[model samples]
Target chain A: MSQTFSLAIDAMGGDNAPDIVLDGLELAAERHPKARFLLIGDEARIGAMLARRPRAAKLCMLRHAPGVISAEMKPTAALRQGRNSSMRLAIDAVASGEASGVVSAGNTGALMALAKIVVKTLPEIDRPALAAITPSARGDVVMLDLGANVQCDARNLVEFAVMGDTFARAVLGLTAPSFGLLNVGSEELKGDERVRQAAEVLRESHIGPNFHGFIEGHDIAAGTVDVVVTDGFTGNVALKTGEGALKLMRDLLRQVFTSSVPARMGYLLARPALDRLREWMDPRRYNGAILLGLNGVVVKSHGGTDATGFAHAVDVAMDMVTHRFNDRIREGLSMLSTPARVPVPATAPR
Target chain B: MSQTFSLAIDAMGGDNAPDIVLDGLELAAERHPKARFLLIGDEARIGAMLARRPRAAKLCMLRHAPGVISAEMKPTAALRQGRNSSMRLAIDAVASGEASGVVSAGNTGALMALAKIVVKTLPEIDRPALAAITPSARGDVVMLDLGANVQCDARNLVEFAVMGDTFARAVLGLTAPSFGLLNVGSEELKGDERVRQAAEVLRESHIGPNFHGFIEGHDIAAGTVDVVVTDGFTGNVALKTGEGALKLMRDLLRQVFTSSVPARMGYLLARPALDRLREWMDPRRYNGAILLGLNGVVVKSHGGTDATGFAHAVDVAMDMVTHRFNDRIREGLSMLSTPARVPVPATAPR
Candidate 1:
């Protein structure tokens, strides 16, 4: 089966649905060349929106989805009853093997609930994670459990660490990626018992000390590690804090830049550099929140994400398909079962 | 009622203790003309080191304490066996009402454990929070539960918010302190059952909505709210992560600044601007963790804090002294008794 024309997008989801979704899909189609999208939304509305735009030749035909999942709807009801809801329908397409992967900008709760119940996890995979790209000091940091599972067990964290490592390797193209635990301190035994136990499991596992042990929020921007692992609760806080902080700084910078004529002049002179800095720090750079440890890849974009962000998500999906990330995760798990494994050299970043 | 002329330093704690501890205290004393110290350690070694330095006045006099508290020492054991230890003597000076406040560069567990037993918390206060200053996008952001309690409860959170608010208003001088529960989302229903309950208590409490409401980790740095509150466990994690991310950024910026010839040239020209930015982002600017809800003001500085960091801590102490912060906290709590009477401003950074 040709896996080229993949990605089933939850077109009816997000704040600016169908319009932004279609725009993202169209741009992604142009960028990927090989990729096509199955837009899940009301056929008439989607078609109307499409007609207004100079449609890309690669735009996949619209797939009518009967209902739109309200962002505020309860996840339980949304998952159980949202059969025709665009988000659910998108997931259904993936579940039924009509699409290679799925992307949603709907309520995270509903998406997680539906994906876990329908798309399901691979054998021995107890839970899935909401992994987002965090701004680290060095580069982008992949933070897991942005808000999926609140209560985490040691085994779950280990799985998260492993899954995050795989995602980093596949998407970021960093082989033998460095992993760090989100903790209060860098030293061993500095965090809660659960974190401490997870650290031990990570250390003893084949992952080795590329497992850089404990990391704090300050380290998030340091880029000391490729992947930072934690429970959904903590990771959600960290991710939001990072995003909020970046936005806040930019806002403050703008305020200061516009405070006085001299400052404004300085800002103008430094516009290119500042723009580069802002662009680098912008949340749009890392738009996709990929849910890992499942049979198929699932990427969640922000509800307010625009076409640019959507295009990035699609690119991430393409990378997922090209790298066969899920297979690598399965293979990594299998390698754990077999002892005395040969050392794998780290995958350097592209 | 008389405070001591000198203090006993905890020569060991954190990753860069003893050495950094000595350097920091020495620097603090030199900078502050009124400051004096009583170094607690091996008399011979401390004396020898002191002799090597040019001394004017009895600035830092050594006080011998044979045993040391290891950073890994269990809290209970540290308290039990530390009767004659350096930490206790320092606290003893305070319990005996000799020193105004004690400073330690030793294990946090031991310090807090000793502090609770000796200094004790204020009446009506359920627990004391390890409150500290965080550099937000705009300015200083106050957070609590930096490293005290672990298992979180709604009541505990209520106390944290109340005390954290007072701390912010008194310490940071914000018009009306923002109070927020560091949870998964800004919405009232976000996070675990405990967090949901806490959010309600916070929302309906005398603290008004302008007092700010539920804040996520992202809100901490986003500068939307002035104060971010959580249990020690979560707060501790956020604090560390923030610190780690900042350090990572600093290190990475250094790398980027010296990456190539053009970069090096830019660094030279932009040195002044970059220096200004670094100062604005300096962790030291917002240093010192306040053990709030306690009877007396107590600040926990980085055991490895340099002179600059220590000065920040001293400033925090001075601010507390000047603002009568403890009294304000008590007043804030007492106001809670007349439920329908007063309004406590909720200033949560969103």
Candidate 2:
């Protein structure tokens, strides 16, 4: 077993809580034998859940935590309270070097706040953003600020582009991702003043120099662009739309498949092929929402994440650590600071 | 024949120009014998293209114009010079009462500028918006400002709700449509300052009394909200994203179907059912990009539209006229005008 990496899992994090969290840990461990885990929550709840799965034994260890972070409390308040909460302990496990990363399906805002206050950002990064990978026509497309740092300055947007690029390269394996600024129109000046200003700065990013100018909302999964960048507000709206669209399509496809005898027979023949196709788009297989650009690694999942979703999130942490995402981010930023390709003149520094 | 509903066609408007435009005019004329068209463009090009088309004795008429609107020029500047251009002549026909509406596939900005300067907004309408119907999971979703106004205030957003609701009712043939404001999150206060304020205004709209409140991007096709409203910037992005997603899915499905022998066999067996599915998802069938709230009727089609695409756009114009979409918009807005939804507060009579 490789003891070089570990993931702190908040056993009490999701709507399914310890049960799903523990199941995910077991699944990830089986796939990644070298992995190690720390399960933090009510010891009894986690213990009982893991007892139900004897095979999970060699992969995980448990640590007791007294409090839990609720989804409703403000992010900062939750983080402040999470000092003793299991979710925070998972984060602390990494900060304290007991683990390499943390995974949770807890309050998204709390994870973000705790990661920022506890883990800290790289030297130059102003704020961290939430990035989600959508299985696009071309493959996976990284879109960010799904809902973090709502009000951003032009510089904050520049940081988002840089962070998103790193996540794409590190997570999605795109060497030099094609980045796009999500705008209302493809025209050069077609959005709010902030978006317009951000476009200029992003266009000037030398770190991710392959920026593909502006992209529209409809372009998110078009496979036309590798990375779609936007402020947290816009990103969140776009992300929600994607989720809704997928669900809607799935429901419609289900109806069509079961419509009649001929349709049912056709669906039966198409079943295996559809299975393979779905495996490619399956959210569980691709689960992971990295809070990019944070000093420490934090991976989030749906609050109702099942055993598989939780495992994917934990594996996401393992990938971040394995790739040394933060280290590379720092190196790339430093390189840009020295002499970015699209040089931002000293006088024009954002 | 309905003599009051003649339309002028800009023969040189689309990328295919006179050829496709004339083809669409012929198809549309066959469907609506009352619909007459004045084909405005170079007489030589029109004559050349018409020579190939079956000569209809009772076909639409043609008018010659020497100038053409180049796709490259600035929108306002193009409008100013295109007065003698084919597109301008088409708009002029509507303005001069020679035609009831104009159809063009030229630059949208130029079209809007021409419509605004020539035909002008309705009695109480402040700005005209471009509303395009995009293919949704269910059918088609009407999204406004696909590229109309960029910077809009709360009042403008409220206007969009009224306009969109009216379009939904008259254009989409829905009764008392459910309205939704597009925001980053579905929460009431979770968007840009403009969206937050717009939400408040829209929620109170007499026309939006049945408003479904804030909707995220995914709701565009979820069939949850009948009409999703946002500024032109976001709306345009959402509209384009929908377009791109449809294209991406089609391409992906094609690739999957042809990847393996089993998949191909499955596709063959299901060809009939799949064909119906394809027809339902085809972007061209649902074609029509209506410039809503304009002083006069103008619809933009795919710049690369074929006869079918152009025919659909023309069909949209006819339907709007037949349903009196513009008149309905005015009525909807009147019922939703500021401070008129309720009796004045006694304490705030001033």
Candidate 3:
């Protein structure tokens, strides 16, 4: 536990709202007893929930916010009408230097929009990327632009590489994490000009020794490198596609274990190992999406996630705060040379 | 089996070459006894292998092709230097009307480049798309543009919809296949201009009744639609990412079951069910990548696959030929109004 650390919590976000948010804090507080929280939401509801959890209530400083950003609200609308929203106030705490970071399980678009406008991005960063830590065959891999900038130029992609590199080192505990640019194919001449130019910049950068060249989609789960970087469109698609595949497997396995009496008996015998497997593959273990290149750390937890998942998101925000993630990014960016200008084609190459 | 149906075979394409090709023919021949093959490769090697399977040998006509396209060869280079290649000859047979279709397990880029040039595309089709039938929760899902055209305009996407619709009906035996345009989100305004315009066109076309609107990446495995349409880059990445996720699941399951003695016993008891699950998930059963919008049926098998997988590719080609896939596509295209000219943005939208 970091004795001086504190984080802002958006208590009114997510499906379960104040209940799960308070419950999550109770769990997180047990793990990091010294850390404090500035809980921003409806004071009455939060206070009632906090009363039920005495320890979490003792550690939380409740602040009243009259509005909440609905999950279905558009980013532009949220920005225009969300002055006193819990999500906004929580992020403001980080910008006002009251907290080291902010965590929310609210509307993704709203959170991202507010974070960008309120905390703003680093001076060297053009756009912040959404990075997630996913379990891979080798270990954990950090992938960026999970759903941030849908369209990216070579400069944007190069910036993501630097941020993702810094992220892997801080969170995954990798000393020199190898990163790869995600493309349709691993060849030097496979994708569009933007991808090729990003590869070229990385190849010539100070961190070139840590660059693993281009890698295909399959390399993500294979853990071909420590960081996998791509534009939000492909990265988002790839992320959801992976989730879909995993769900399909789970469904198929359920059918298999229930097909016969022998399978039922086998299920009993294998229950322990199966339990371990479930724990290993649990979504809660990797619940947070860190918005990189932002001036302050902002972690987005899945809106539908339970208390356990929310706790994991809190853990991610704490990790960044304790590790000085922003300082490292600034250092990394300062050490790099700007990528050469390459005219990207209007359309993708054949 | 249609007695008149004969598929041109690239006998020296895959990793195993003539031996696997001949062996695959033997297996495929059993499933379609009336079908004949025009096998193209080194005569002596194919002949010697064909001799081992007398039944297959009797049904095959061997053609000599001294060259082979290496996996690493670029598409342009392959077309330039691989004129006498087995892959090229097989595609040539289709163009010359000597064979109903062509099946190749060669380099994907080379196979695609040659097929597009020699066999040509449908008169109304602007670009050919690679289609694959993947197993899903509800049943099999047909997805297209899996690396055929890197970037696609709205017109290109509309064509893919028509072709994908026909492909699902022919291969999956669906009477009316519902199709969805793949995008980052399900909202009409979620993705770039190309996707929205494609959706608009589909909304007004003859197939509008069958169009299910925009779907996210998870919809591919959810089997929300019978056909999933996307540009080549996203589709290809999604396909490989699914494969990677499945592989990760398998590795994790193995570790889970083998962790303890009870788990091992349970695995044995569940062995029958597990085997069935494995069979259902086997890559060989879904090995072919059909190049849709082509004038003739063309199937690309995995270059590293064995006889069983190759046979599956042949089975796919046979399905297309028997169903008159090209004619169906022409009919589908003729029934629809041309896509309205909507300006597609150069890159995916934020």
Candidate 4:
């Protein structure tokens, strides 16, 4: 087995804590046989859980952490009191170069605050954005600024576009991923001044060929572009709105299929087809939320997720590490800094 | 027949113009026998189409409009060059006291600009907002600022809340509608400075009893509040995202239900249940996009919508006129102008 990568996990984060975390590691270990884990949490609890999962125990090394950050803890308070907490230590592992990345299912605000402070950001990146994979009409689409920066300026938006483009290439395995800036309307004159300015900057950048201009919310699901770029406020709202709509549809479908005996019989006959639909829409398949533009890869799994969902989150981090995601982002930024086909003035040094 | 209401129709606005417009009027005429229409369009084509629809012809008076605004025309260009166009004439009919309201399926930007300029806003309203009815898990919810005012200040948000509250009561037949401000997170300190300031103003107002506090985007589809208020940028994005998600699910379900022979047979047995689902999700049921805060009611039908969708738009206008929607809005604004209880200071005037 190859032993080139290691991931630090907050074993005490999330609802199920050590048990679900250990079981999730077992599932991830089965898929990534070479991966090693640095599990940070209560040593006694983790040891007992690991005893039941031999496959995970073989690949994981346990580290004791005396404190735990509660799910309800605020970011400021958590950072002040959570220095020795499992979540913070796991992040510290990545900062200290002991682990390639960090994964947690803890309080989102606390995790973001600690990760931003501990893992740090790339030299060129002002803020790290939270990106996730969403199921679209054509396939998966990458959307960012899920809740990282509340109010982004034009510069922030341009930065997000560059980060999102690199992320789509790394995670989705696309060679030349196309991107679109999210706006109310697709017209050049639509939306606010900030959005129009960002569009103009993107239009003149090195990535102009792959930039698909402004796209509306519907285009996100239409798979009109590989990447969707937006400010945190809009992106977060769009994400939750889509999730709520899906839930409502699922509930309505359940009611329809169970309203009558004939419908029940039809459901039985179509069980295999229904299963395929469920698998396709399963939340576990699209579980990971990557905090991009950071120095080390950091992923946040859903707090209520089971082993399968947690495994998917680990897989996302592994994909980033294996592909050297940060290096690609740096290269993309360099290209952005130097414009293509622009002649330098004679007075300036070339 | 009663002659209390007359609506100005932009017959040359939509894709399948004159014919669809006449047909939709026919359907609407049947439902509201007392209502009359002032049709503004190319007189030759409208008269030809109206000959077949005796019901609509009985209530319609055709007027000639030599100019027509193309769908590709920008709002500014359309306004400057389209003074004699069908859309402008329709608005002029309302301004001239010949019609109670105006309904059009034209270029949205052109329609908005013309309506705001000719129809004008109410004295208390700084800006006219676009509001729409959205289907939710619980029932119908009213969402405002769909795309009119992009960047809203705290005062603008408060005004939208009051307007949305009155709109929900007038059109949706709600007695005491509840309100929620859309934010990235549900926490009090979750959003940007403007959202927080808006929340504070709402909290201190007489409408505080009906205010549902800050809500995330998911609450829109979950029907957590009767009225959802936000800046135009975020609301537009959320609205389209929800629509896109619904479309994606519909497409995916089609593929799943027709994948195999057994699944095909199952679909036949489940046809009745599926039909019910289709009726529930029909776009025609929620077709109208109302321009609120205007002196007169203005509804924009989807440009690509058919006769049935256009009829729905007319129905929304009739409901507002019959209910005296603008009167109700004035009453609500008066209540906002006078607070429930005043905490007078030593130097304040009584």
Candidate 5:
């Protein structure tokens, strides 16, 4: 709990900008007393906000960043024109070795582009994937390539599996986490050639024993595996669909509880237990989406999140830094590169 | 109601086979009154079950099929060796003009393959898509390509849009249902080339006014559009993910209500209202998945569903038959084939 580390913060990012960023820093400061922050944003504004929060001020050092990246800015445009932006400066800090990690709630496309271009990807990684912890029936499950790569080849999928496995271990503390490649069916012949090829490689690699072959979408929420590997397009859709379904259920539950006087009374009697359910399902508990396979830790918080949610993102970055997530991924990749004991056939039987 | 139309039933299909099939027929018999059924299965087994249901027996003609296709049978194997299977015979009834449609609670892969080969695709449709009704916050939403074609070209997507639009009109009674192509984002340049090309074609087509450019997965449950069109892989994953999330929420709610004595008392008082919510969200209500763009109506019921769920599938087929769903699609396809008012740019700006 007393481990010393520093994270570069994008103070002028997200919807509420400096306010929520500073407030979240205050909460994070209380939790990680030994951790230091280099707040990169408009100096005058961040300085004024820090003046109001004595706790955040004690652990934060203001770094002036005059420019700001808008939510609607294109990734390519942001990279070309956002050299002095807060998001850019925060990432720069990580690249320059001034901070161990960077946390941003800015435009996701811009953040990914900047981090990949500035901080760069790990040597063995083809592409750095967007990985996040999603809620499952049994517990938290990790899913990756969430809109980072719309089209993924077999090699990319194999890399994602390695990164996801290392991620679950470093963050979730799973000793030997089980993972599955997302497919239309659990059968080997379910998906396209690329998916089938990826499955074959995983089945023959170092992680073969822990590989669950293939899993359907329901298996995600059913907690059939600890890590779910998928292409960016499908993963993004599945993640959003899960979120929308949960929202619909919550809405319907609210309507059911307020339908009549008796129903309202029932809600009052069940308030205690219902509150526990609410706490368990809180979106803030799973806010940070790490850009895995990157040379340095990069976490993207939900743009619309509040102080508590932002604080949770910081916690995720801290965990990745302290636990040496990148180092674990490097080890996993090396193990994957080791030749298989039994040579896999050129075209494995489906 | 008295305008008679016959449907072939695969009585030797599903987990509960003849019993649930017969019970479903009895229910459908009451609802349709004058509708007749050509029940295909083992003679002795189906006959005995039908004889017990006086209402179903009064409106049914038994067609004995010697074989039954197991759920695990591969599509190729089913097509090659399952000539006399109840499912095959049922689809054959449609092909031979003995029945207007066919309903089966059998292997989905076998059902789709058999239906494509036997019932055949429409003249204008490049490929048939699997379309199903899903619950949304606003109302029922139609999603397509749930697992028919793993990879689709721009033409296949445009065809799906036209068929989906017609389906909404015939089944959901939405005269001008707005539709959106599912993607990672609503931005023009977000997805692969195929999706972008499909969007351009749809925007220039006859249904252009009713076409929402692009939609994310959450748009399905938000009811932002009536029809959500995507390739088989993503659609299948999104559908199951939504189902899994709903199941998770339901399980959580049950746990909350049974956690303590007061919570149990609260459940009793709120039973009536919660019952309404349960009925509204019942999976049986959305049991049928129609194979769209086919020459004849082909409905696939969930293999493990019970009598009520089977009956719902029958209801969906009946709706398609009575509403002249195929005729509507023919008209829609003609409209699409007509020359556009303005020539779409070969490479439209993103």
Candidate 6:
């Protein structure tokens, strides 16, 4: 805690750009006084914003980048032409060890592609996955592969489980977090072959004691486990579905509260309780989507998030860097690779 | 409309068993006065329950079923051992022409397996899909392949689209419904090869005009399309995720409303408006899951649902039977199989 660490910030990313980025940095700086930031963007614009925020200015070292990745740009296009882009420069900072981690709110696909090529994945992982903290009935749950790989084999899924376990330990502060493989049903023969194979391997591996077996979609919100792992396609769909459902309920609640005069008065009386509920369910509290299995930490903030949400993303990056998330993943993978010890026979000599 | 049709009911299915089944039958009978029911279960129990409901007794024909399929029994095990089970006999009634359709609140897997073998599939259909009506922001949305086939190829997806289209027309009363293939993103290249291939085929088929291309998980609740189509694995997960999210919101709302005296009074004043919201969001309104692509209509009710929910399942069955769902599917498939008409050049001979 005594040593200062630096995080690379993509100042030109997100909907609000350098303004919110700088404001978020000021807030993050206040929280982590020992943390320094390498702000990567157009130097002139970033320098102007830093002048207004004394706290962020005191801790920031600005770096110039001329280009920005648009949300609609294809990953391939971004990779080909976004060499001097703020996102690329920020990731480069992590790869070159100029910073311990990088945080961006730009296009997700572009970030994943650029980060994989520049910062590289851990040697033990076949493919890196997108992991995010989602609100559940019991508390927050970690789910992986929100949309990194369109299709995955059994090996990729097993790797996701390992990353998810380390992620829960590092970020959620759970020592022995239970995890489940997402599937159609909890039965042994329910999902596709890939999922079944993954379950089998997890059951026999070192982390088998914490594996809760196959879980269905509802289990995500039910907080059936601390971590949920699946192929990118299914995981992405489930995450979005949950978001959409929550949005629908919120909209309906608003409609109900404004339906009549009685309802309006009731809303006034219930405002405090409802406010507590709203705060508990706020999307800003769970803004960061960490791309796990990378050699260095990478957190992707929601593109539309404001200063507070962006600051939460920085907090996630700081936690990962300080907790040595990648080191834990390395240890977990080694444990997985080691075969289970067989019990010695009583008749045989020890 | 002039002819009376009989529906076979599995009296021993569901958590409540013969009691709710008969009560639901009485309600269904009141709605469809001309309809008759072949109540298949333990004759004595069904007869005893029917005695309490005069309307259901007047319209029901009691048939003895010696066995019942447990919810936890596997599909294959049920197939081999459930010959005289209420669920199997109800399906047999449809196959034997004793009833126009079959409705069960039994084990979904058993119902699907038995219905597929007994009722058989439409000649043009390669695989039958589990289609259900889900509540969406715009209204009711039809989603297919809820969990019939865990692994589906492009062909299966294309067929599901055809079935979904007919299902929307027959059950939801939509003349032309917009349908989309569910994926990770809305882009053409966002999903796996199977989805892209299916999209290509759908784009060129007869339903091309109504095809909405690729949609993400959020689109299901957004009602971006009238029908949401996907492989069983993803579709099932998405469905349950949506359900889970809604449940979470409802639970939170209740906790907020009862958190204190002021909140409790607020609940009383808002009771009417909240009741309307509850009705609109009620899972019972959308209880039936239809097994589409089969020769005869088959509806599965939620096992834990009460009498009112069971009645909704019977209503769905009646709608499919009256609308001739399979016949429409046949027409749609024939159109798909027949190549699109080619436009001749004006300069060339026609």
Q: Is candidate 1 or candidate 2 better by DockQ?
A: 2
Model 6: clashing residue pairs? none
RMSD (Cα, Å) for all candidates, in order, is 6.1, 4.4, 2.7, 4.7, 3.3, 5.9
lDDT of 4 by residue, B227-329 (tens): 9999898999999999998888888888878888888777778779988897888888888899999878899999888899999999999898888899988
Question: Fnat per model, in the order given?
Answer: 0.46, 0.52, 0.75, 0.73, 0.77, 0.84
Cα lDDT tens digits, model 2, A288-341, are 788877766789988887888887887778888889888987776665543333
Each model's TM-score for chain A is 0.93, 0.91, 0.95, 0.94, 0.95, 0.94
Residue B65 CA error for candidate 5 (Å)? Answer: 0.5
Candidate lDDT (C-alpha), each: 0.72, 0.75, 0.88, 0.86, 0.89, 0.88
Provide the lDDT at B42 for model 5.
99
Tell me how many clashing residue pairs each candidate has: 41, 6, 0, 0, 0, 0
Q: Would candidate 4 be rated incorrect, acceptable, medium or high by CAPRI criteria?
A: medium
In model 5 chain A, the worst 10-residue window by lDDT is A341-350
Q: What is the lDDT of candidate 6?
A: 0.88
Predicted candidate 1 versus true structure: per-residue lDDT over B275-331, tens digit per residue: 677788887777677777765656677765675776577667657755878788888
- Pick the winner on TM-score between candidates 1 and 4: 4
Q: Which prediction has the highest lDDT against the true structure?
A: 5
Q: DockQ for each candidate?
A: 0.32, 0.36, 0.62, 0.49, 0.56, 0.49
Candidate 4 segments exceeding 4 Å error: A1-5, A337-350, B1-5, B337-350
**Lowest lDDT 10-residue stretch of candidate 6 chain A:** A341-350
Local error of candidate 1 at B94, Å?
1.9
Q: Candidate 3, after superposition: displacement of residue B85 in Å?
A: 1.1
Q: What is the TM-score of each predicted model, taking all chains together? A: 0.84, 0.90, 0.96, 0.95, 0.96, 0.95
Q: Pull out the clashing pairs in model 2.
A: A217-B237, A217-B241, A218-B240, A218-B241, A219-B241, A241-B218
> How close to the true structure is residue B203 of candidate 6, measured as C-alpha lDDT?
89
Query: How well is each residue in A249-325 modelled by candidate 6, as lDDT tens digits?
Result: 88888988999999989999999999998888888899999999988899999999999999999999999998988
Task: Write model 5 residue lDDT over A1-350, tens digit each, in one string.
Answer: 22223799999999999889999999998898888888999999889989999998998889999899999999999999999999999999898878889999999999999999999999978888999998999999999989888878777888899999999998999999999999999887888887888888898888889999899999999999999999999999999999888888888889989998888888988889999888777888899999998878999999999999999999999899889888989988888844432333333111
- Write model 1 residue lDDT over A1-350, tens digit each, in one string: 44434778888888988778888877777777766677778987887777665443345757898898888888888966798898988888777777778988888888888888788897857688888777765677788978888777666787888888888888887878898988777778576677777777677777855799988767677777899898888888777766665565566556656655655565555555556666776677789888887777788888898999988888887799778888888877765533312232222100
Candidate number with greatest DockQ: 3
Q: Is candidate 3 or candidate 6 better by DockQ?
A: 3
